[model samples]
Target: MHGVVQHSLIILAVLTSLGVIFGLVLAYANKKMAIEVNPLIHIVEDVLPKGQCGACGFAGCMAYAEAVVTNPDVPPNLCTPGKDPVAKLVGDLTGKAAAAVEPRIAQVKCAGTHTKAVKANEYHGVQDCVAANLLFGGPKSCKFGCLGLGTCVKACPFGAMTMSEDGLPIIDPDKCTGCAKCETVCPKKVIAMMPIGAHVRVNCNSHDKGAVAKKACSVSCIGCTLCVKECQYGAIKMDNNLAVVDAKVCMEKCDNPTCLAKCPTKAIRQAVLGIVPGNEETVA
Candidate 1:
C-alpha cells in the first residue's frame, strides 16, 4: 500500500512539473510572437462608419481600419460606408490628405418589375437570382433586365435594399453605403453606381434593338434617341439603342426633364428628386 501511495505521489509530482514547464513555454512564446497593433488602427476605426459593409474591398470596418494604418498602399478613401466624413477622419488620423471621392449610390438600371415586364419562362426550382440567371439569361424576355429574384437585396449587408411587390429591388439612398455589393452580385449586371443627387438615370439595361426591346419589356428603352434630341445640354447619348444620361452634364445644363416626359417607355427617371416635371419646383 505504501509503495502504491509513493507511486501515486510520484505521478502527481511529474504531472505538476510538466504543467509548470508547459506554462512557461507558452508564456515565452506569447511574449515573443505578440503582434504589435498600430496606434492608428484604433484612430481609424473610430472614424469609420461602423457599417462594416466591406465596400472598401475588406471584410469589415475593423479590417479596413487595420489595412489603412498598416498598409501604405491602402487608400484612406477606401471606405465607401463612411464616405467623405470617414475619409476626412482617416486622413486626419493618418496625417495624409484625403483623396477626393465622388459620392455615389446604387441605381437599378432595369425598371422591368414583374408587373412591368412579361416573363419569358416560369422558373420551377431555386429562387436565387444567380441560379435563375444560369438557365438562359433569366426568366425575363429582356436578357439585360433584373432577374427580380432578390439576389441584390439578399447581398446587401445593410438593410438598404428591399424587393418591391413588383419584384424589382428598390434602394433606400439613406441606408446605402454604395458598397457595390449589389452591383457585383447581379448576374445580369443591371445595377449601376451613380451620383447620389443626379437628376436623370437610364432605367433600362437592354442593349437589344428597338423592336426587340419593345416586344420584351414595355418600359425598356427602345433606343428611339428621343432623349438625345430633347437634351439641350448634350447629356443624353445613344449607345446600342440605349440612352445613357451623363449625370455631370445633366446636372449642369439639363434643368428640364423633357427627356423624362418624351421617353415613350418612361425609361429615364429623375433620381432621388423623383417624378417632378420640368418647369416645376423640385421637391426636397
Candidate 2:
C-alpha cells in the first residue's frame, strides 16, 4: 500500500508538471501569435444589419467588417442590407467615400399563380425549392418559373417574403432589406433585385417559346417583341424568348408606359415602385 501510494504521488506530480509546462507554452504562443484585429471592425460591424446574407460578397457580417476596416480597397457600401444610412455611417467611421447605394428591392419575377400555371406533376417530397427543383425542375410545367415551396419565404432574413393563396411568393418592398437572400436561395432564379424607383417589371421567368410558354402559364412572357417595339425609349428587350425591361430607361424616358398595354399576355406590369399590390398576392 505504501509503495502504491508513492507511485501514485509520482505519477500525479509528473502529470502536474507536464500540464504546467504545456499551459505555459500555449500561453506564450497565444500572446506571440495573436493578430490584433482593429477595434473599428467591431464598430463597423455594429452598424451592420447582421443579416449575414452574404450580399456583400463576404461570408458574413464579421468578414465584411474586417475587410472594410483592414482593406483600403474594400468599399464600405458593399452591405446591401445596410442600405445608404449604414453606408454613410461606415464611410464616416472609415474616412472613405461611400458612393450612394441605389435603393433596391427584391421582386418575384414569375407571375404564375395556381390558376394560371399548369403543374406537370404533384410534388410530395422534401419541402425545399432546391430539393424540389432536383426532381425535374419541380412540378411546374414552366421550367424557369417559381416552385412555390416557400423556400424564398423561409430564406428571407428580413421577413419580406410570404406565400400567396395563389401559390406564389409576394415581396413586401417595405420589409425587404434587399439582402438578396431569397434571390440566392431560389432554385428557379425567379426572385430579382430591382431599383426601388423603377416601376416597370416583366413578371415572367419562362424562356419557353411564345406558344410553349403560353401553354405552361397564362401570364408567361411570350417574347412577341411588341413591348420592345412599342417602347419609344428602347426600354424592353428580348433574350431567351423572354421580355426584359430596362427599368431605368422606362422610368426616366417614358411617363406613360405603353408596353403594359402592348404585352398580349399582360406579363409586363406597372406598379407603384415601393408599394406591393394585393393582400400578400404578387402583382400578376
Candidate 3:
C-alpha cells in the first residue's frame, strides 16, 4: 500500500509539472503572437448590425469597423444594414460627422412572370439561376428575364427577397438592406436598386425592340418612348432599347406626373408597393 501511494504521488507530480510547463509556454506564445486590434474597432463592431453584406466596400463588419477606426477617409454611414442609428453612434464614437444614408430598395426589373414571359424550353437540371442561365441562356424566351430559380434569394444575406408564386422574385423593402447582393448574384441582371420614393420605374429589362420584345414578354418596355413624350419633365430617356427614368428629375424635381398614365405597355408606372423601407405584404 505504501509503495502504491508513492508511485501515485510521483505520477501526479509529473503530470502537474508538465501541465504547468505547457500552460506557461502557451501564455508566453500568446503574448508574443497577439495582434494589436484597436479597442475602438470592437466598439464600432458592436454597434454595427453585423450583416456582413459588404455594401460598405470592406470585406465584413469587423473589417469595416477596423477601417472606420483607423482610416479617416472611410465614412461611418457606409453600412446599409446599420442605417442611420448605427451611423450616428459610429460618428459619435469616431468623432466624425456621418451623412444620412439614402434609403433604397431592390426592385426586380423584370415584371415578366411565368404567365407574362414566354418560355423557350423547360430546364430539368440543377435548380440554380447561375447554373440554369448557362443552359442556353435559361429556359425563358426572353434572355434578360429572371430565371426564377432563387439565386438572388440565396445570395441575399438579409431576409429581404422571396420567390413569388408567379415564379418571380418579390423584394421586401423593409427587410432589404440595399446591399446589392441580390443584384450581384442575379444571372439575368434583372434586379436594380432604386430610391425608395422614386415615382416612375420601367420594370422591363428586355432590349428587343417593339414586336420582338412584346412577343417575348407582354409587359416589355419596347423602347416606345410614349411615356417620354408624355412626361412634362424630361426625365425619361431611351437607352439600348430600354426606357431609363432619370431619378433626380422625375422623383424629386418633377411635379406633373403624366408618364404613369401615358405608358402604353404600362411598363413605366407608379410604384404601387412600398418603394422605401416600410411594412408591406410582398408575397402574392
Please give the lDDT score at residue 22 for candidate 3: 100
RMSD of each: 4.1, 2.6, 4.9
C-alpha local distance difference test of each model: 0.82, 0.86, 0.83
- How do these models rank on TM-score, best leading? 2, 3, 1
Q: What TM-score goes with each of the models?
A: 0.85, 0.91, 0.86
- Please say which candidate is ahead in TM-score: 1 or 2: 2
Residue-by-residue lDDT tens digits, candidate 3, 1-284: 99999999999999999999999999999999999987999999999987788889899999999999999999899998887888999999999999999888788777887788899999998999999999999999999888989999988898888888788887877788888888888888888888878776778888888899999988888888888788777888898899998877887778767776777777776654533211121321
lDDT of 1 by residue, 1-284 (tens): 99999999999999999999999999999999999888879878887877766788898888988888888788889888777887988888877788877888888888787777888899886999899988987888999998888888888988888877777788887788788889989998988888877887888899999999988988889998988998888888998888998898888776677787788877777675222111112442
Clashes of 1: 0
Task: Give the candidates in order of lDDT, highest first.
Answer: 2, 3, 1
Off by over 4 Å in 3: 1-27, 274-284
lDDT of 1 at 83: 79
Worst 10 residues of 3 by lDDT: 275-284
